[model samples]
Target chain A: MKVKTVAEYVASGEKPEILFWVGCAGSFDARAKKVSIAFAKILSSVGISFAILGNEESCTGDPARRAGNEFLFQMSAIQNIETLNSYEVQKIVTTCPHCFNTLKNEYPKIGGKYEVLHHTQLIQSLIEEGKLKIEGGAFAGKRVTYHDSCYLGRVNGEYEAPRAILNELDATFIEMDENKTRGLCCGAGGAQMFKEDEPGDKRINVQRVEQAMKTQPDVIAANCPFCITMLMDGLKAKEKQDDVMVCDISELIVQSNGL
Target chain B: MTIAQIIFILLTIAVFTVAFRQFKRVVDNIKLGKSEDIAGDSVQRWQNVALVAFGQKKMFKRFIPAILHFFIYAAFLMTQVELIEIFIDGFFGVHRFFADKLGVLYTMIIGFIEILSVLAFVSTLVFLWRRNILKVPRFIKPEMNGWPKLDGNLILYGEILLLIGIFSMNGADVVLQKLDPAHYPDTGTLPVSSWLGPALFGGLGEGALHMVERFGWWLHILVVFGFILYLPYSKHLHIFFAFPNVYFSKLKSRGEMENMPEIMNEVKSMMGLIEDTGDMSDDIPEFGSRDIRDLSWKTILEAYTCTECGRCTSECPANITGKKLSPRKIMMDIRDRAEEVGTKIRSGNPEYIAEDKKEAGATLTIDNFDDGKSLFDYITNEELYACTTCNACVEACPVMISPVEPILEMRRYDILTNSQGPSDWLPMFNSMENGGAVWQLPDERGAWTKEIEA
Candidate 1:
């Protein structure tokens, strides 16, 4: 996996079709990093000429804004906007819904306008174009339930894209009782991922995982890295990690195609 | 006019003057908040008012209570026509004024009102039971312990008294009509009261019946006047504010928060979109709300419009999880604080009065209070930080209030102005400033990719 930075692409005088906005979790979190790789592999196999910002990429200031530090959010958003504008980037794809949402919805107001797509949307488009093929190599008959990240499903109204991609894998697609627009938070949104959980009778992620377990899923598919981290911790809490695998939608595609 | 009629007119004028003055004060206090225009999209705003306020769509989420509330709400409006008639009789001393002209229509209308009164009375009892006996969890939160609890019961009791007065007066009127058909006239209809009213007062002499009717009539009118005056100070203010509040609600996507334009302007200047006027360096206006005055006037209107239904708090994830942040309490506090500041200003407190005179045309902020108490004085940092910004409260609010907006604004003040927040937020803040991420270093970003390749 030879990753090309925007700076490299610029120096070579060649522009990639899309800039991959690998977010903080995708870049740093141990488990979320796997999703970044899986998504990158999917793009590579499909022959999409997308380049990541590499070291030049900074956080999209989502956490800062959510944490209520408006000044910090502005500082970060400005730097990222300047870098993206300098690259003359037109389209962006990311595996993190927080980054996806901030870039797609929040950036335009600050003058950094670009066509942003969540990885699931990109995967769905690739499948539609027949550029990527999945034969359901291992997960053909497995019960897979997809958890809707708050930003993607409720906020963005993008319930169809991830589910559509999962359907293409020929898996036994089950639905959580709380799914799509009515989906519950995985307890990591609003910068809760970086901080300690608030005192409560039960952790929200645990409750969400219980809802996922009700479907008796063999694979719990997630679209956001934050959701993956929270749901995986939830599975671990239930001691069901060995029995049920928690994976990203892109990871499922790579496994299905044996890419 | 007789002396009694002259005195009655003066009293009516006095009550009207006091109630109107209080109402005007509330309007002025709401105007004290900084304005944000919510006057576009007339069709959609009207639709929101129709659905949320009149349709009571959100109220129906709880079926039993919704039914009970609907009876009371519908009866309250229908009874206004009856109240108008009472007002005419009070001033002009013309009993059953519409009876002869309206004929059957008047009879049918009175019959309907009688049935609605009985229904309203029964529903009030049920509501009282829910509040006092059943003790529904939503109604019994810690904040509802003292005045809020008594305030709710007081409104219900007031409604009961008004219903009783109407029934008793109708019963007496029926007896008087039978005794003197020429003077009283065979006008109004009373189905339930016709039987029940006579059963209680049939044994009374004609003179005693007249006295009972006079007492009931006077009590009903006086209670109605008192209820009007109490409304501006009570949570029941929702009766008047709900329609306008829902009409002016944010029609944008529920998940989208409004970006601070001042902050955006600073970023634009930094990006060289406009000339750097050095406004960013001069004074550096606070980034978020610190008090009710800092909030938009529409948000203040939301506070005034809250019915204290606890729907928002019940649906809030943080409150459900034992966090201190109750959305219902947030709205209530805003209203309470605004009232407090407004009262202090009207009292001509030397400090605030001097400051107001100095500022002249300037916008009111937390400093206008002069009490040194801010939103932070009451709202804890733990509560503000606990919110997930999920918009569940906004979705559940019957009046279309957005509690998260104020919570977020207070948080902005804490972070940008006060330079304080949760301890865990420090690293994330530093990371965002240095590396554009929550991580401390940019080099570590690609570590995950390398591990997967290996």
Candidate 2:
């Protein structure tokens, strides 16, 4: 069976072992890619069959739409729907908050529909089902804090899942001054990751990274590539690269997975 | 020329010249895209309060300021008749009785307005006390607190004096209205003047209010003249600039985001062919935010017009998150820098930056070299990179300053020219190049999409 948007993909006559729809953010970044790969391995390790689609995946066009370029953004959206429908794929797990936001919110505006979750949400669900386990948080002397990527926390309201996963790790999980419902922007939203940012206020990333640092955590954990990207830059820019490390929240989990 | 006409014409000419210069400078600043230049505004998320935040119709939300400004703003608008009398006295040498036919009704109208104006003035004085003497922490710096060198007492006294003059004129007019009842027969109908006429002049010796009226009227005329002369120098300058500022506010023309450059523009080319004219907004050289100097001019203007309203500060998620970045402060810093360089625009300040560097000569009086010190220190790379590019500040800015554009542009410069931000972005960029997404290219990241089909 072939389908394009999640609506069509869901209604398709035939389903693959697991319908794999590569999110624009999920398909593009390396760290995110690693997390998704880890997520797939975890699901398979628990006897959940799945296939990851790649060729037809492209940008979700969040950057183009935000930079006030609506024409190409719509075009990208239309093409994405068409391509995804042809593959008969659905149910996407995104690693970038911006892409997640676009697919969840903006896609409906253009008539595409699907079920989506951040990798942590999926992994946490698997863990809840007793299909996944935490091996032990062996790292010590680490005051770790989780950076709530905007899409997962504010946009889609996945506040507990990532925090739950972090909590299970048994590491220090302190909250940033503005976390969860009021998480600070990672400075990479609205397609800001793509275009040039005019100098006005302080760099959004550095400000957020600094906020994450105020937690005085040894590791700044995050769920989105954009947040990870910006926070890492902010850490380096502040010359605290050696002191406070930024990593994918999944990276830590993967490390503890004994993979 | 008559002395009155001479002074009026000369002052008017001077004012016209200054206003024209100001307008021209403002246009040039807009052309440089110096205001509201940040990249996002996700902080100012409050829903409109329905005729309140925008209307300022009621001042209780901020009491002292509301009351004080209510009178000050009202007096400037309401005291026109008082001015008519002032003009009559100045031109015809007749303070009260000369325009006897229209004087009573005119005086009554002026009296009622003055009462409201006095209410505003008295409240403003109270505000000055709270901010200076009591040091109340409100949304903004009250007039007295804004300029510390200013003595709160002196300023409050001046405000009090203005109120006094208003009432004195009101009081004296009461005397005159009762004394010469025939000429000002209709004064009894006015709300305040009617009541005052009987009190200040009622119980006194049969005609004593007449004598007192003459003295009060004289002093009133003098105070009115003082107010006229003091208009330009007083911080009450907002009485004039506010209306114009509102009228000339920059409106957002389009809703969809502006087209981002295809690729972050590069400052230089690998071959000798590319020119680094700062048009780094191209498809080449990865993202670069080299220095403070690379910021767009519009970002500078957003900084200048900040009223320090604290609206942006209150709405910023980063500020809520305990980050040091404040959109309001960003505008304040930029405006402060622009002002420092404004006077000798032709000479170009050494502290200014490349984008808005004024030339050392007239004509093409703009240059590209600003060593970037003092003013540059306020904007840290961390702060610049921390902004989430949310549209919150843009929505909250009453003056229509878009504080996000310049922030994004500078980031672009940093990413393209400096090659500096977080090293992880390099791997992410590589991923975007290959996978067209931020996730692993060939991974089962799409199984969610697959699951939907299943």
Candidate 3:
């Protein structure tokens, strides 16, 4: 894709309306990459003028801070902030709640300030504004349950945005018993995603998956890329990969719009 | 005054003075930690104190233990009325001081206390059964062995002895009042002990009744004094610290992690937000906690406030998963290390004395001053990394202690100061430092978008 960078947009004497922050998971993880593609398709189909940081973008240092290396976290946050400030970027939308959370909450404390939104929030807003239309294409009557990411739901109090997108899809929406603020972690947060599981009788992701299975939805919809990865792994572990589809909310939105 | 009276007064003063001095020393030790401003939101803080400490809200998450603990706690506070009476009677050589003035109210109070004492005693018996017979998993963790186990039993035994002493004294006093109405007036009520008085001491002579009353009175007073002296060194110290600890607890959202000011300044300077003050010296500023001294005074106070109840450990995902980390042991280790350092300073240990002198104005690496051992000496790296940074421990603490604070700080020290951490984290750190992502290259960020465009 010939995605225009912020610097390229500025050089051409124009400005992108929003900066799409492609986090490490969205950029690299094979499964998450499809979510990034789906979200990009949605943005492009909606004719939103969004530019990416491209090669200039870096990690937001959420994992570094959570892992207890404040020095590394600051170093990364500063580098990204400097690049962001240089472009005078105003609104940022990311597919990862971890990135969305750090940029929205932690960045202001360190000088990087902007209106940060998760992809689900942007999708909901776009639908509300009549800029995008969902005709209930593929997702119509599909049984889908949304898994709330911790950073988005518990940490930031964003329980409705993703559910609003699912509601727009006209799907048979089911809610997990532990949805929203009370939702359990996918066991990949706090830098656990990058390391081996701590010694325990049962994996946390497995426990979370068992909770999801109780609802018996055909599609386990997620917003955060990290959640997608963890939930996909959970389904794989339980040998239910064939029975249930693990998908990002963006993928569902794109599928519903037939983009 | 009689010679016995004078001696009793002297002994009481001596015990109190020692207890006060010991308490002052502990406060000084806690003050050694770095200052952190926990002051804000007065209304919320007081609410926390009321709900967590006084209300025992967190403790009631379990049914049987909470009821038993409440029984003992309520009895202990109520029994303070009796203690005050003993204090006045011992000093003024007056028997039943409040009895004459309070009249029937005094009798009702005594009756209430008698029932509470029996309840407290029964609660103690249940606690003993849980610890020794039932062997609750939380109470019998490996760290609870040796002095911790002995201390738990000793406190329970102390409660029993104190209750027995009060009951026995009341019984003997009843018998003495009946035999010698001229000297010992019948003023107070003893519903439980009144029956026992005649059953046990009815056959005894007048002189013997006086001796028994005196002995029981002396036993109760001496045990009360001994408990005071022993508390500063025991986990029972939580009884005094819980209120203040909850008051000073972090009132912010549990998910919010405090940003390090030192690192923030560096970032500000990097962003050209402020002048680059080049006063930087050879001493690299420590980014996170390396030892007990590196933690905030509030955290130090938290260590002292810990009841060693193991409620946090029980709720910890890491511990539940069979990980080496136990939040209870983490708090205990911090307390033990703080006490060890405090004792060394008091005993004029050369290393601690040198460190103390350096604190006057000298710039030294904070980690270098520690006595051959640091937090890592006791707390393993496996345990440190195993934590998911979940606030379950903080939520589980009845006194509002955040064990995760120290764990994160120590992890910071391990990564920043020691340049050591779990080996798996190195690649991620490097990727973040180089590409601003956990992946190998920054350019790979938009590669997925190409598929959609194609």
Top-lDDT structure, candidate number = 1
Error of 2 at B222 (Å): 10
Better of 2 and 3 by DockQ: 3
Residue B280 in model 2: shift from native, Å? 8.4
- Candidate 3, residues B1-454, lDDT tens digits: the string is 9776798899988998999999997797788688898768899988988888899998887788999999999988888998899888899898878877888888888888888888889999999999999999999988899999999999999888888788777888888887787777676657887888878888888888888888888888888888999988999899999999989988765556788867767666776877776534456677688777888988989999998999888867667657788999999988888887777666654454345455554433333354667777778888888887656677567788999889888988888888888788888888887777896753566676677668
lDDT (0-100) at residue B28 of candidate 2? 57
Candidate number that wins on lDDT, 1 or 3: 1
Error of 1 at B167 (Å): 2.8
Candidate lDDT scores, in order, read 0.84, 0.56, 0.83
DockQ-based ranking:
1, 3, 2
Per-model DockQ: 0.48, 0.11, 0.41
Chain A TM-score of prediction number 1:
0.98
Give lDDT: candidate 2, residue A125.
Answer: 89
Which window of ten consecutive residues has the lowest lDDT sum in model 1 chain B?
A: B360-369
Cα RMSDs of all predictions?
3.8, 11.2, 4.9
Question: Where does the lowest 10-residue lDDT sum fall in candidate 3 chain A?
Answer: A178-187
Give the local distance difference test score of model 2: 0.56
Query: Which candidate wins on DockQ?
Result: 1
